[model samples]
Target: MSFTLAIVGRPNVGKSTLFNRLVGKRLALVDDQPGVTRDLREGEARLGDLRFTVIDTAGLEEATDESLQGRMRRLTERAVDMADVCLFLIDARAGVTPSDEVFADILRRRADHVILACNKAEGSAADAGVYESYGLGLGEPVRLSAEHGEGLNELYTLLAPVAETFEARAAADAPEVEVDVNEDGEVDADAPRKPTVDKPLQVAVVGRPNAGKSTLINKILGEDRLLTGPEAGITRDSISLTLDWDGMPTRIFDTAGMRKRAKVQDKVEKLSVADGLRAVKFAEVVVVLLDAAIPFEQQDLRIADLAEREGRAVVLAVNKWDVETEKQQKLRDLREAFERLLPQLRGAPLVTVSAKTGRGLDRLRAAVEKAHDVWNTRISTAQLNRWLTGMVEAHPPPAPGGRRIKLRYMTQAKTRPPGFVVMCSHPDKLPESYSRYLVNGLREDFDMPGTPIRLHMRSQSSKNPYKNKKKSTPSRLRKHIHGRGGAQG
Candidate 1:
């Protein structure tokens, strides 16, 4: 079950800081800038023994009735409605302001459970503000320095009860249901999980600065809609452009160039890089544009690795391909370099195209679609089992401490990178080498090379199908009638 908790607060109140803290990574872009987080970003979070999803929302601000801020506020309110709880953060140093009071009123009127937190409360100076937050009527404020990782334990304790109650309510309200996945790969009324509306397929164009991200988008758009320049880091925020590719809705994002981590200095640049990463996370397909002059840099490999780890479909587009004289050699070298550098994304579709010259654009689109198709590929349980049997027979699971590992049933639990769950005797006892072998074998057998494959092993106890049935007894009346039968109730 997935329960969401949304973090809401004014701008620069360390909401993104706390968001990153809870999600256990830099999933949200954090900056001193007020509105760095314009979109509601959701991530899976773990607090103590509780696991739920958390959403980092845009800052609340006053806006004209028909302004962008109004729309953003509407979106934020919608996120709050979607969540099971709301964490309203206030700047401890600045104390509660008029805007905070307004937000408090809104939360109090709507939200049943609101956890107020005094952010940036590191020293005695914040004590007064923390006390003032009690006026909001949202119970005792959980003092926290989101940047310094303070007051999380108290926050967890407060959340545990709420989490438990939410879980209980969910279980009680949930319908008694069984799912039957049909052969057509579509879910019927009995399906386990039903997805929401399938929106446009997201494609992110990412590479070094001046790799023609905006130019690529402009070319595809056939207009100079996005700002293009020879300057680096020209585009800070990721801009999403929607279009139709063969009648299928597709959204392409033009992101800022991601430089090597060692060189990242300015606060805005850092935020921009983080935004690019978030775009990658949300994308289904990533077209890594490469400069013809300086292709296959270390940073490019790192970015590709990030995409693979995120289970995104990857397409390597060699931008400025028209300018290169040694086309065949460059292509070969690029392929060879990618194979060596990013083996996880090996065999990923590579196309040579000039975003400036509009050359090979069709091929780039075709490669992207192909990669997307591969990413969504799924295999049957019976087929997977057959392949598994063959693999174990050919090179069986290795044994450590003289105990042979017993791998039982295998099934593809989910698609979108083709995740499989294998039932084994001891999952933790399985060596990494053996796991890699099975994953590689699946990739090879299914002809899904370069597509990220996740194989998770679990230790499950087998159960008899008739374990729950009660034994029937013969009746005494029937025995009397039949003379030689046993007694029954």
Candidate 2:
């Protein structure tokens, strides 16, 4: 029994700030710059026992052409249409402008329910603007200061009735069913309750700007859910969507393209890059999209390395493959560059796809599934000990200063990137090369290619029972000593 509420208004009116407050996280990038938010981001919102979905949309503008602002405005309008109620906000200190009036008219016509709110009304500076909002002909405006957390109680009061109505409707619409019980007052064993299933896998799609990330996602969804164009840096927010792929539930995040730190001079772009990094951290598998014609650029390598460092299952997707004329040579070049430039992600699935034409999507999905499986792989203690024995025999650990480092036992400490702990003597003396050797063996022998493996060496000193006890002289020695003393006397 949940409904969606879209926070819509002109730019710099604190829509994102309010969104962050409602969702209890900084999911939306917030800055003083207008038009910073270019996509619709949704989150679960709760306030005073009320639960619903909240959407943060781009600022409403008066553009109507093919400009970026115009596209952003259209996207915001789509969010308004999907939302159950639209919270149209205006800067209380600045008062309502012509753009606000125009957008208010649009929301009045589009949204079935609308809640007018005047934000930034923390002090008397906004009093005049709050009083002037009555001229809009909508209802009373809720006084709010999103940054300072003011006037939220009034908002909850206003929304309680709407939430009640929704709950009642949902309860009435729910289907009714009957269950049978035996005379012993127990339910029939044949009618077992269904087991709960796990949530969908979280996969994030990320790369440099204009790498066809949005286009690839659109191809998968078979619709234009994400806005796409030839413009670079079109996507500014990391948008997540859920879908069913071949009977498997999967949630995918489309993140903003990452650029070199030196090249990113704008504040909004910095926030965008930070948002993309957050998405990678939140995701279980990360798809590093690359332009097929120019694969493995410095920025591309950085993105892949970042993913690997985050311990996410990595999959390389070379987009726009349909335009490549020399397929075999290009693929060979890609593989060579991948191996040479980024050995950290060696043997990771490098999938080539044409996002526009929807080519090789199946292979990409399969590779993602495989990478996730490998990332979550676990090995039994027996198997790990056996593997450790063979590895040590093949390449015994180095002994510095003639003191041999004893390798005792090995076991997997955890999964989800497969961490292992090896008990040995003189763990501090273990070299990095030996650790790499064991990790590579685990990857190759365990069929865990491209998955990050953690091997920890622990020092286990052998205990000596007699070392802590006081030593006593032997009886024979003591008797001999006494006899020697008497003979000397």
Candidate 3:
């Protein structure tokens, strides 16, 4: 394992900003608000040639049991315990407070190694607060500014020796391997492993508030990794977790509940919704979770349609299956409502599950895996052309202005929400209904249900072979005229 560093400090001390700087990406949500980060987020951090695992933790609060802030404190304390070294930050601009002193004492007693950092130390005005940080008795504080990328070299110098020790330990602990020959006469140890080109499938779970989106993820992970309670919008950030599901590596993003835009008046909630939309765009498959008791609400339909419009593979998950009575009637009603309300996701997988009871989770996983595969489905050129030919023969193109529009060729231009391009005559004349028919045919013929299919029609340009030839009088007409003149003479 690489060396681990945890950034811990009181609220609003710029721990997250520094974490984002080190990770070289905006993985953690940053704002002026305190307690924006309520969970421990881990990222691989780099400082020049030094690389290590860095964790951005929730601000250390004095609370220690049961309340929300208490839970957050416990989580941060866990990070402190797991880390090889803790970078305890103090806001130089605001100076040290009682909470910072409390945390400093805790780290001094608990952490194996501690590095004091005074953030917002770029300006001369911060000199007094920088001096005040020395009273924490940790060490000479490393004056730094995380936002402006200042003082990283000093941070690197402190971490270099730690990284070297980690590397040395890893090299020493590596086990020796014995080579063996296989039945095919090849050395088993020398045989190269195939490089994996496909990344972990990205899935985003989204729905209205209190739709059990987080519950479903917790059920799948078989743990309470996400904080859940009898409250709406408990989750504020789009948190991504990696797991092994059914022998497949999957990265699942549990986003904040998305309510209708008109009802969302708060700035933080709006940011949460925007973050959820971003997750949908990044995902290969999106599971639109719905409360089974109140399935297909207007907001739910809107969410599903949004996923479809984003060209993402969609799977409808009706959560709270255990609470619903009259299972047969409920299923029938759900199917009808789904078909009538969201035809854009026609033939998509509609799975019913109880996140509370862990029922139907297997089916949900199966549906997600299947949807991901279909999203990446690619049709061969020959197969696509043949299917196009059959579709055209079954339902010929519209003949506008008494001219038959010819569709000459067709091919798939791309996959991952498969897209096709067709060369035809008068592509503009083709009706939207015809395009829908062709897309439906492609879906049905290729057995690609629930996957988006894109089709493009291009009018083939007509060529004239004799356009370069000068338009001289016909030879026959010239001969007839000459002959007539001779006769008249």
Candidate number with greatest lDDT: 2
Candidate 2 residue pairs in backbone clash: none
Model 3 is weakest, by summed lDDT over 10 consecutive residues, at: 188-197
- Against the true structure, candidate 3 reaches a TM-score of 0.88
Better model by TM-score: candidate 1 vs candidate 2? 2
Q: Which pairs in model 3 have colliding backbones?
A: none
RMSD of 1: 13.5
Question: TM-scores of all models?
Answer: 0.58, 0.89, 0.88
Query: Per-residue error at 21 for model 2, in Å?
Result: 1.2
C-alpha positional error of residue 26 in candidate 2 after TM-score superposition, expressed in Å: 1.7
**For residue 293, what is the lDDT in candidate 1?**
90
Q: Per-residue lDDT tens digits of candidate 2, residues 248-354?
A: 58888999999999999998898889989999999988999999877888999999999998889899999999999999989988889888998877789999999
Question: What order do you get sorting by TM-score, best first?
Answer: 2, 3, 1
Highest-TM-score candidate: 2
RMSD of 3: 6.9
Task: Point out where model 2 deviates above 4 Å.
Answer: 175-198, 470-489
Estimate, for each residue in 1-489, the C-alpha lDDT of model 3 and write its tens digit.
Answer: 589999999988999899999999987778898878776777889899988999888888888778888877887888898899999999998998998999999999999999999999998989999999999999899999999999999998888888889999999998998978777985443222211224677889999999998889989998777767677887777888788877768888999898888999987788888888999999989999999878888899889988998899999999999988899999999999888888777899999999999999999999988887788777778887888788889889889999988989888787778889999998888899999998888778888898888889997788788889888998999999999999999
lDDT of 1 by residue, 1-489 (tens): 656799999989998889889889876677676877665666778877889988888888777354656656776887778788999999999999999999999998877779999999999999999999999989899989989898999999988888788789888899888977778985443232212225778899999888988888889888655655555666666766677765557888878899999999988888788888889999888998889899888888888888889998899988988889998888889888888888788778888999888999899888987787778777788998898888889998877789888889899888777799999987899989898898888777787777788999999866787799997556876657666443442
